[model samples]
Target: MRAIVVERTGGPEVLAPADRADPVPGPGEVVIDVAAAGVNFIDIYHRSGHYKMPLPFTPGIEAAGTVTAVGPDVTGLSAGDLVASSDVRGAYAERAVIDADRAVPVPAALSAEDAAAAMLQGMTAHYLTHSTYAVQPGDTVLVHAAAGGMGLLLTQYVKLLGGRVIGTVSTPDKERLAREAGADEIVGYAGCAAAVRELTGGEGVPVVYDGVGKATFEDSLAALRRRGTLALYGAASGPVPPFDPARLAPSGSLFLTRPTLVHHIATREELTTRATDVLTRIARGELRLHIGRRYRLADARTAHEDLAGRRTTGKLLLLP
Candidate 1:
């Protein structure tokens, strides 16, 4: 099977297309004939050594496909079960062996590409809105990178909760997208978080969702009111600078949490429940997935380059 292998961490160019031996399922694993793979910020972090991983691995984390075989101890699934998974290895390939516990059945109304697009990012948006802080109606929230993959869906989710969404984007075009996603106000964050103070009448917001990391961490916390929450989900700009927790107290007695979907949806049941909520919304045409970029499986490097460069708007995928 062909897979994009990362032997050394550096940049997108480090990803080399290779034909490796086909993966065989281990106990509790299932081998999927991958039809689509989702590209994620974490994949880039893994590839660049920003997030440490053992050397020599495939980069993608999420994919959707058909099960070709199930491993020992796997049950309630069979060959030809249409499914999607997150937090798995070797997804950027023609076929991948993922833990059976991580795979969720796909809805008939959702296509492979759409399901792949929704799996990781959609669930992240779900858990972020549902668990991280449990956003409430009439609450004022600020979402950075509000035109990006999870941002668009999150904007909608926040709006659905009746929260006021103040989205920060880098460009005028993205501002329009944020508005369409139901953001109450869109601010330009070309490189700063001062807009938060401006957009919220100097009172700051109740929650600050910062995925831009290094560039926006401190300001994101500062943009919140006393006792508000600061949820940092990604680090596209770079890893956040070290800070004193005492600063959080003085800033506003703020709550800070760094969350990941894997931590939120730890088991098959949890994974299935969260995935169903997002997929059902998509199936109902309530949640929107903008598949902003598509690349052939062999073009994985290009996909990484665009994502790392912040040239992408929404979900990016690789199809074989």
Candidate 2:
């Protein structure tokens, strides 16, 4: 099997291609012949050492593929099954092994590319709208990075739940994309809070979904209505600095939470429920995925370069 390994975490240049013996399934595990791997910000964290992993590890955490081998003690799945999963490392390869319990069946209506693209980001958006803040009809919410992969999906899901979205983007092209995804108001980072205030008639929104941490944290706090929540999910712009909890009191008595997909999908049932909900919505044409770019397996370095440079939009993928 050919896989990209990071012997040392530093830059995208460290992702090197190498040949290794095919992975063998362990008890309660399944070996997948990876059809597509989803390139995400988490992968960048791993490669850059922001998220530490054991040395000489493969970086990806999400992918969709066909099961070629099923290990002992695994039930309700078999060879030749199509599956997709998040929170599994080693996805940046032609083959990878994962626990059977962590893999979910991919509906026939979705292609391999779509399944891989939708798993991590789709599930993240799912829990954000339905669990963390529970968006309601007539509720206005703010979403940062509104033109990126997660942003687009978050925008669509908020609309599906009957909420209006105020999206923040970095460019004119992104503003158009955010609007297409159902955002009611689109603004750049320079005046995002003022724009949100204007859109809400100075009342602000009920919740602010912020993934671009550090850079937008203060603005996110200012964009919320009294008693609103701030769901800080990611740090694409970089991790946020430590701060005093006392600040929340003056910011409209806002609620603040930092949620991760791993925590939300901790149980097998929860994982399946969220994954199923997102995938079924896609199958029914209620939600859509935008795959911005595709790269060959060996071009993993370039993929990371573009992602870290913020040179691409939507979901980026690697076809093995």
Candidate 3:
């Protein structure tokens, strides 16, 4: 077996692929022969020491593949079932262990690659639109990084719920992609604040999804109508600096929250429900996943370099 081990908190190069003993199923866990691993910005944070983890570990959180074995206490899943899972150990390898509670059966219609692509980004987008803000019909919302993985999914899902999406992107190519994903107005983020005002008739949207964080926080705060909500989920441009809560009142009396998927879908039932809804849409062709980059397990460094430099869009995957 081979695993991309994170020997230290440093650069992507620190993820060194080496032969290692294959992970075996423990009680309440299953061993998956991984076909794909989902690469996320959080992987970068772990590499950079922004998110602390025990050193000498594998650097992936999500994977999809065929189940080879299941441990005692595991039920509903059997060997040879195609599945996708998050909250797993050492997913960036030939084989990984998945907690039975966190594993979800992938739709039979979906390919292994597609299942892997949708698990993390799709779940995040689903929870953001349907759980965190719970956007309703006629709600005008803004999505930053709208060309990226979660951004595309969120835009489409929000529109499917009859809400309007104002998407911000760094380039014309991404702007085109965002529009294809149901973004009603695609704004070039160079003059984002002004563009947002124009798009909203100077009133701004009702909710701003700010994953770009420090780079777009102030403008995202500005691009909202009174009593609007700002869902700051990720900090791709770096974390938001400290601020005063009282400032929310002066800034259109806004509501702000930092939401994560773990908090929103804590229980096994909640996780399975959300995963089923999102995966059903994808399987039925109502929603689509764009896997913009693919890297072999050994090329994890190059993958991170491209992602950190914003050289890729949509979901990035590591084929094991």
Point to the candidate with the largest TM-score.
Answer: 2
Across 124-188, the per-residue lDDT of candidate 3 in tens digits comes to 88888887788899988999999999899999999989999989988999988999999998887
Give the whole-model CA lDDT for all candidates, comma-separated: 0.88, 0.93, 0.89
Tens digits of lDDT, candidate 2, 88-203: 66999999998999999999999989999999999999999999999999899999999899999999999999999989888898888899989988888987899899999999
Q: Give candidate 2 regions above 4 Å deviation.
A: none
Query: Which of candidates 1 and 2 is the stronger one according to TM-score?
Result: 2
- The true-structure Cα RMSD of candidate 3 reads 1.0
Instruction: Order candidates by TM-score, high to low.
Output: 2, 3, 1
TM-score quality measure for candidate 1? 0.96
Candidate 1 C-alpha error for residue 252, in Å = 1.5
Estimated TM-score for each candidate: 0.96, 0.99, 0.98
Model 1 C-alpha lDDT per residue in residues 161-206, reported as the tens digit of each score: 8899988898888888888889888876653456777777788888
- Segments in model 1 whose C-alpha atoms lie over 4 Å from true places: 190-194
